[model samples]
Target: MSATLYYFDGRGKAEIVRLAMAAAKVPFTQVDIKEKQQFETLRAEGKLIFGQLPMVEYEGNHLVQSCSIARYFASKGNFLGSNEQERLKVDILFEGTRDFNTAFMPYGFLGFKEVLDNAKNTAMPRYLPIYNFILSRNGSNGHLVGSKLSLADLGLLEVILTIEELLGEDELKPYPEVQNFLKVMKSNEGLASYLRSDLRRRKNDERYVAEVKGVLY
Candidate 1:
């Protein structure tokens, strides 16, 4: 399916789905909502089911919500897991990322050290250890579910990348298993290419930040 993702010029909530799509080796184009009017227009036209973005027009369906789009891509990519139990594990891990995303979104958009500090100090401690443990328990195999990669793995990479962008790359030093998982996943050709390409925004852009603040603030 030819997927068209609508979001801001930067990654925002769209990154995970993009990463998943990339990993799935599916081709999708980005429609950057660089202006407030652009998003407003889509909402006015009822293109957005929830009047919000990170929406994907895929296979003749307009998929709204960040996690829903990611889940769709995961399902299409066979990354949600191979079995019921494994899929549940994927959901669990993905939910952790979603939780962190909800909590840290303000800081991500505003670039506030105080907020980032609170999340890094409070939330990171609680979440990172569990991720580290999960990876470790799974033999630190870089896959949170079975032997192959899944949404859990992609979600972890997305979270780790965000932490790296805000807290610096060395932030994962305390959690070697999670850190190693990041390293191992980066070796995937699709993921690596996306990471190194302009298709993926590795760091939040100031202009995009201003646009998001202008619209949502």
Candidate 2:
């Protein structure tokens, strides 16, 4: 059976898993949690395990933690690495993306605009340049750890797309290396299709705010 994912209707933290699945060509189903009551019911049934979302039912296991779920899908798709050394590199870069994502997420009363601004200005400057350098060192070809795509690449793609949603596109114009890397990744057939599909979420606007608030409040 395909894995079952339970998360918010919008992307939020769960989109990485979807992207990983798409890259892996693995089909799965999802249960969209648009309200606090839906989340409560899942938690009441012990499906959430930690009373939190981004949970996946795969291989008879209930998995939570955004990074853990992303890792699971990425690993399933053989996107982790080809060897121990490559896996180590993937882990290092993936953790950085996790930290970058952690710096911005949902809080009912918290201003979404404030979070996006911090992510774009403070967080983007500190991380994007370093990532751009890493890409340039790797020939700016999009693969971060090896000749093939890995979890690190997927993580960075998500980060870049999120920034695009914030800046109305090409927010990484100053970071040419990273922007080039983005082009290479977007050229992938599977990823390109998913990007054009309806699965991708919208910008951090009122609709996003309402969805998050509905789930939290």
Candidate 3:
């Protein structure tokens, strides 16, 4: 089946979806809307669901929401889980990453030193410990669900890398399991290649950072 992902030019919410597809060796077209005018035009045309991005057109069907789209691709690639319980474990960690992103994105967009400090001091302490615990429970094998790779792993990897970029390399040092998990995920051939490819944007690209800051401030 043919698939095309629609999102902003930068990584943002769509990176997990792209990572999943790439890891699974699934071929699909990526449509990056680089201009606000293009995004507005698509929204005005009523083509985007929920008036937002990270939508996927798969086999003529439109799927919305970043997590849902990523899950769909994971299912298609057989990276979800082998059974019901495993799927639940995967979902829990996947949703946890989403919650972490929800808490982190606002501070990122605020683009102020105080906001960053608050996140570093308060929010990270609250959330990272829980994520670190989850990783420890799973043996910190770089896979968040079962003993194999899942969408949860990809999701957590994105969040971890984003946090590392915003904070620093040593930000996850307090969570050794999480740090090990990051190393394992980055060692995957497909993910490693994608990270080095032109398709992947630097986490702190000024253009995307400025765009987010402008929208918030």
Best candidate per lDDT, number?
A: 1
lDDT of 1 at 135: 86
lDDT of 2 by residue, 101-202 (tens): 665654223676677777777888889888888888887567888888898999888888777765656577888888788888899887898888876655
Question: How well does candidate 2 score on lDDT at residue 24?
Answer: 79
lDDT, candidate 3, 22-45, per-residue tens: 787766677767667767777787
lDDT of 1 by residue, 1-217 (tens): 6789898777778888899999988888888877778888888888898888888888787889888888878888799888899989889988987786655667645557777888877888888999898888998577788888898888888878888777887888999998888888999898998888778864565666787777765
Q: Which stretches of candidate 1 lie over 4 Å from their true place?
A: 108-111
Residue 160 Cα positional deviation in candidate 3, in Å, after optimal superposition: 0.8
Candidate 3 regions off by >4 Å?
204-206, 209-217
Task: Give the TM-score (vs. native) of candidate 2.
Answer: 0.89
Off by over 4 Å in 2: 106-109
RMSD of each: 1.7, 2.1, 2.7
Which residue pairs in model 2 clash with each other?
none
> Which candidate number would show the highest TM-score if scored against the true structure?
1
